[model samples]
Target: MTDARDPIVRIEGVTKAFGSFTALHEMNLSIASGEFVTFLGPSGCGKSTTLRILGGFETPNTGRVILDGQDVTALPPNKRNVNMVFQDYALFPNMTVRRNIAFGLELKGMGKAAIAARISELASFLELTAYLDRRPDQLSGGQRQRVALARALAPDPALLLLDEPLGALDAKLRGQVQVELKAIQRRTNKTFFFVTHDQEEALTMSDRIVVMNKGRIEQDGTPEDLYFRPASRFVAEFIGETNLLTGQAIGRDQDVTGFDWQGNRLRAIASPGVGATATTASLRPERVQVAQERPGTDNAVQGRVVNRLFKGHRMLLDVAVGNTVIQAYTDTDRGRAIEDGPVWLGWNANSLTLLAD
Candidate 1:
């Protein structure tokens, strides 16, 4: 059993460079045992590079990688206790699902019966028992991905690295697989290090999320932490839909910090060193309540509804406040009642996050 309190993987001041370009800049991260940690960022943000280094496919230019209690920075791919599930579902084309899953066990020279048992166990766990005899080309994308997962999990490695493993599936299939993957992780109780550029995927699947930008870790926290209390402007904008308003911090009263935006006074949660500094407030679209009459809130703004988009259960309204546009979401009935006209948007102080500019 994996110890939840122990650090399964510790990346200490790791840096990677490709000639003049630096891919990772003194990156430091610690992943707990049996935790589902996702490295989230856009392309060229060093998420994949970090995964590659962890998998022993690429050597870091500096620092050390400690797996469990030992330093495995210099270890080769085969010598390390980590397995990777690639984006393309890298399964042998000629082999059946059974053979594909048993490939690693066969290499380890396990008894034929033992290898068969392992494959059977993994297939059953991943819901692939029905497709055990099928080839890679004969199965659907989701099935093939499951087979690939079974192959990786058959050897029972200490950590599983998933590099955009669901990138090939369609939107609906991807959602289905995501739930299955999380269930499988819980059932196996193994450390998972997932890398992806999709923010929703990261939020939905991670125990903790490490958001990267320009080869550096911008923020690392739970999905709720990143969404509700973003540390930086990049994190505020990257993690989800948010309205950013640039203002000058005027003063503070206990836990409330006041800011001056365009001629309006706005208050947010207390900010450290907020007095006299330029600050930005991040408000989620759903947090802003829209109505014809002014609502009871710490802050209220009057604006003209520029556009309204019906999104099934909810309606998205683009309201223009001064020169900036604020996006707000409301129930379909309430939204249609106040469509394309002047409206008042209000939000409580707790909903507004004050960020350093």
Candidate 2:
């Protein structure tokens, strides 16, 4: 793995416009070599635009793009030392698997024997050794994807770009291939710039995530940081399931603040420079505890049972208090015979996160 500060690709004040509308603002970011970074968001959040800019498919209207200390802003896609895997797995229908994997090497003027050797090496690594002579149409979706990946890696590019590469796979196969892709990246020590709209996929595979909205970055951090310490309400609501508590600041100190929601009062620890005037709080579903008896805390509240869902390993409870709904997660092993009899909801001091902006 590469150090986070040692950037291999840097974008400075990069902006893109489509005639009148701006697709990307003056954005700036850095991706380290050998880092598995993902650009994650909903559709039309400029995630695809950023990927296209990095892949040399689109030029930014302003600012520069640097790759490995070299300026590549005006370079065409073929000149940039990067490879991209598309969502459709663009394989040659007439070529065999071996030829598809060796196509890049052939284009680079490598000897036929060397190309064959490299193709064999890559096929073995991807466990496609037995399907070398089969065409893409003769192989399964996962096999064709592996062949596409092998072809992209044959040239040993400095960066690999994946644009929803696994979107075409079935859900069960997608999960299986995610494990395989992570393993391949680890074994090869390659830098990956992946784009995906699936939040769970981003959380599962990325070393760091950049969440974008409206052509600008909303939050950039590790999965744990985004999940546990969201910097804004947009991040708190977008990255995961969160119960928003409308509250008003009651008291403030250097490192703590008190908030009042309805008749419930809660204290949350904040940074030294943070203020107590925050108007909202983000409570994660896992942080809320549900029980038949109260835990004797200042954060406890009384709510009526609106719905209960029994998942395989956990139970999801939706409780309504006034106009607000609180979601609580209870493990299945915690006894399920309690019914809807007087539910008590509580969360610890650390679970309450103040949100602003």
Candidate 3:
């Protein structure tokens, strides 16, 4: 068994460049064994490039790739003890599900009996026993995805790299597969390095999220950490729907920091190194409570509801506070009652996060 304390993959000062364009810059990350670390970012943001480097499909222009404390920078894909599942579901069209999954084992020179047993085990685990004889053309998108996963996992590699494996599935199926995938990861205790631009998917599946932007890692933390305590404005804005209020840190008291935004005073959780100059505070829409009467909170603002959107369980309202519009969420009843009139929005000081602008 792999040691829990040891990181399975160590990316040390890795940088990638394509001629004049740099794709990744001095990237350093350590992924522990059995971690579900998702590389999240928009397209052309080097998430895929990082994954490729790890999988040995693309080598870094500088620095080393280490696996289980061994430097593997010069290793090829087949020699790296890693497998990747692509967004395209890269299955052989003519091969049966069983055959597709067994191909890797066969190439590894596993005996026929061992290959059969491995395939049977994986098929049962993935609930693909019934569809083992079917071709990729006969399977649904989710089923094909499961087969692809089975193929990747068949080798029982030390690391599994998934590059948006659920991108091909429909929304409902994608959600279902995400739950299943996490369950499988927990059961197998294998390190998963997933790459995707979908923030929701990253939040739902990752043990830790690495948010990348423009060839660098903006932030790396748990979903709650990234959402509730974002390190930068890009992280706060990229992770979810948030209101970034531009302000200046006036002073600090205990754990709370005071801010001045457009002649309004606000308070938020304080951290070290926050400058006195202009900063931004990220407030989640759900954290902003709306009511007809002013609620008892340290910070409360009055504004007219400029726009409202019904989202089944909750309603999203855009409350115009001066020239800036603050987004708030409330239950359907309260949202419907407020309509287009004036409303009171309140939030505790702890709910606000002071971020570098």
Candidate 4:
């Protein structure tokens, strides 16, 4: 959450190129104070490049980097009021956790009593009171991560930059820390610029997510918006599991669109600027309903059950509709209707979305 005050950071018309390869193309972004924004994309998608440019680690070829209304594009990393937490949690193995957290405060010429007080505050806040005397090598991976985060926060920078800080932990630990990090951000009310290739992580922690592909931004929206209403094929495919149906447009009626897919006439909700000739539709598995008889719905098709994957409470079924396979999910007990034979799949027209790509 953030106040209505102006954005704390802004990147305008930024582009970065190395030799013949372009990393970022006309990157533009604005982040308000206390807003947890995530830069999510695959490798070489310019997410990290954008982060480095904002943190003053790399200079942008053309554009302005404004931090709290002051341009800092040409300033060095240390000169800017920003701190980055590296993926490896670059902590000093030889120093105790208290000393490590106090390193930045010491560099800023803080008094002994003030530095000690600040260390005490961070130690209690990060739940590292008992481990204050332990070195980085003596602490657990999660503790080391917290120590690194505490050290970065000790400086009290205007913005915090995190580059996949949780990549080193195990799956369970990573999931647990994601919640903790989000809680910390809300409590501290500090603007965070995080970069990661993990979709689930981005969805779990961000107030807003910027989806990037190749060398540009694809979509910027809330987690639910990007997951439920993707703007392009790349965003629809990258955000989560989806079934893409490609066909020619048959007709359009306001929001609903009729299309021909593998000789079957299906209808879906069309996006803005969807052409009348050919297009693609995206459908989520959980929205597809499979039954023994065709339900009276706007869209229905017959298919043979080819595969079923059970996951305790729910199950995923792969129904072969002619040559194309459409996947659906149902409750374990309700899934018995399409065990292994021909079945009818039906879904509301509003559930399916016509993609721009």
Candidate 5:
């Protein structure tokens, strides 16, 4: 029996390059069984390259690929217990959903009876029972995506690599599929190695996200951990919208640091890797509360509303405080912040996360 706690996949010292340009550095990461991990980054950030390496489409210049405790660096895609679902799904045009799913099983030399049973099981599991006999052309984008997933999962691979599987769907369908994919991963308990540049997709579907940049892993942690407690400036800005405040540290008390931003005294908790003399912090727009009356918080600042954008339930206000402009997203009914209107921005000390220079 496989222990779910043990790392089923481990990429150790993996490095890949094309000619003089190196793509992946000495990357090392371990993924536990049944965990959903996402390689999230922009284009040319080595996320796709890393996924290709795992699927045997690209060979690493140096490193070992471990699958289920065995070093499979030399193994081909077929030899390794790994399957990939691509952006286009790559489903066969001539075959029905049944044959498409059974293709991998038949390649494994499974009997007809076993393949049929597996197909039935997966069709029901993926809600494709009604479309099992349809060809790829007859199905919708979401249906085709499900078919591709069923086909990939039919092999019962130890790991599934999804390369932007929802990229083909429309915006609304993409969001819907994100939730479905996450639910399917949870239901199947299959370890997923997902690669996508869509931050929202990564945030919504991943149990953990590995933020990559410049051919290297920038930050690796849970969604909340990376979003709320980023370890670096790259992570703070990449994961979501943030206000990178440049300030001077005047003093410290425990984990909290007294910060001076445009002469506004603010208190923020310092994160690891933040030097004592560092002058930067990451504050989310939603953390800034706007009101006419000054909030009784440890940190407060006065500003004039320079711009306001109505976004359904909330409003985004650009407030100008002296020479600095701070963006704050508050409830639509919180207070009226019109252009050139005086507004008070307040937040607790814990809202600011100090960034390391």
Candidate 6:
């Protein structure tokens, strides 16, 4: 088992470029021995590039990659104790399930008994003992993914890198395999660095997440921290569905500020460094509460319901305030059932977050 006290991988000031187009900037990060960290972002955002560098598939133009306290920046793929599970599963067409799982051991020149023992251990963990002789073509999508995972684990690498491992599976199969993947990770306790563009998958599987944008690290924290407290405008909008109300800053103090959205004035309880200029109020749709009549509060706005959508147990309302629209989620049985009429929207003072211009 890997030591839990030490960081298994340390990447410092890593930069990669292809001609004039830079894929990764001088990014610095650390992954603990058994920690499951995910790199989340949109396409061409350098998340895959960073993973490639860590796997020794691509060399960085600047800075160093330190694995297990040793600088392995110049090491080739064969020398590094890291294995990757590709998006396609990348199983050999002619190889049976047993051969695919034992291929890595054969490359390392292990005895037949040793290879068999390792494959048996992995098959039991992944519940693939019955399908040991089946080929990739004969197994289902979920079974193929498990075989890929078992192959990666057969070599016992210090770190396992997954590059969109579930992208090929259908929605229902993805959910089922996701549970299996998490269970396997917990049982092995191997450091995992997963790269994916799916936010829901990242939030559900990762212990911590690193959000990237334009080849730069936007934010890095626990899933709860990123969901609740985003560091920038891009992060707040990218991480989840949020209601962003842009307005001119009308009032300010050391600890509080106010902004004007349309003709409506709203109070903001935000950081002490919030400036008086063009700022935004970020709130989740679920945080917004709707009332038939205006509530007597410091932050309430009068608007008309333009449209309503029934989303099973809850309802979504698009409240129109002059030209601006805000989305609010209301329970099916809660407060006034919204019709195409005038209504009031109320959000708590603390929920209004004043973001940088």
lDDT of 2 at 91: 95
**Candidate 6: residue 222 lDDT (0-100):** 92
Top-down TM-score ranking: 5, 3, 1, 4, 2, 6
lDDT of 4 by residue, 1-357 (tens): 225377999899999999999999998889888889999999999999998998888998899999987899999988888998899999988999999999999989999999999999989999999999999999888889899989999989889999999999999999999999999899888889999999999999999999999889898999988887777889889988899888878898877788888988888877655577647888889989898888887899999998999889998999998878999999988876556998999988877777876
Q: In candidate 2, which residue ranges exceed 4 Å CA deviation?
A: 1-5, 251-255, 269-275, 296-298, 333-335
Candidate 3 TM-score over all chains jointly: 0.96
Comparing 4 with 5 on lDDT, the higher-scoring candidate is: 5
Q: Please give the range of 10 consecutive residues that has the lowest summed lDDT in model 3.
A: 269-278
Q: For model 1, what is the error of residue 84's alpha carbon versus the real structure, in angstroms, after optimal superposition?
A: 0.3
What are the per-residue Cα lDDT tens digits for candidate 3 across 132-204?
A: 9999999999899889999999999999999999988899999999999999999999999999999999999
Decide which is better by lDDT, 2 or 4.
4
The C-alpha local distance difference test score for the whole of candidate 2 amounts to 0.87
C-alpha lDDT of residue 312 in model 3: 99
Q: What residue runs in model 5 are displaced by over 4 Å at the alpha carbon?
A: 335-340
lDDT string for model 6 (146-240, tens) is 99999999999999999999999999999888888988899999889999999989898999999999999988999987776666678788888
CA lDDT, candidate 3, residue 35:
96
Cα shift from native, residue 5, model 1 (Å): 0.8
Q: Which residue pairs in candidate 3 collide?
A: none
lDDT of 5 by residue, 1-357 (tens): 359999999899999999999999999999999999999998999999999999988899999999998888888899999999999999999999999999999999999999999999999999999988899999999899999999999989999999998988999999998999999999999999999999989999999999999899988999998888887888999889998899888888888899999988899987777778878888899889887889898899999988888898988889988888899998886635344588788988888988778
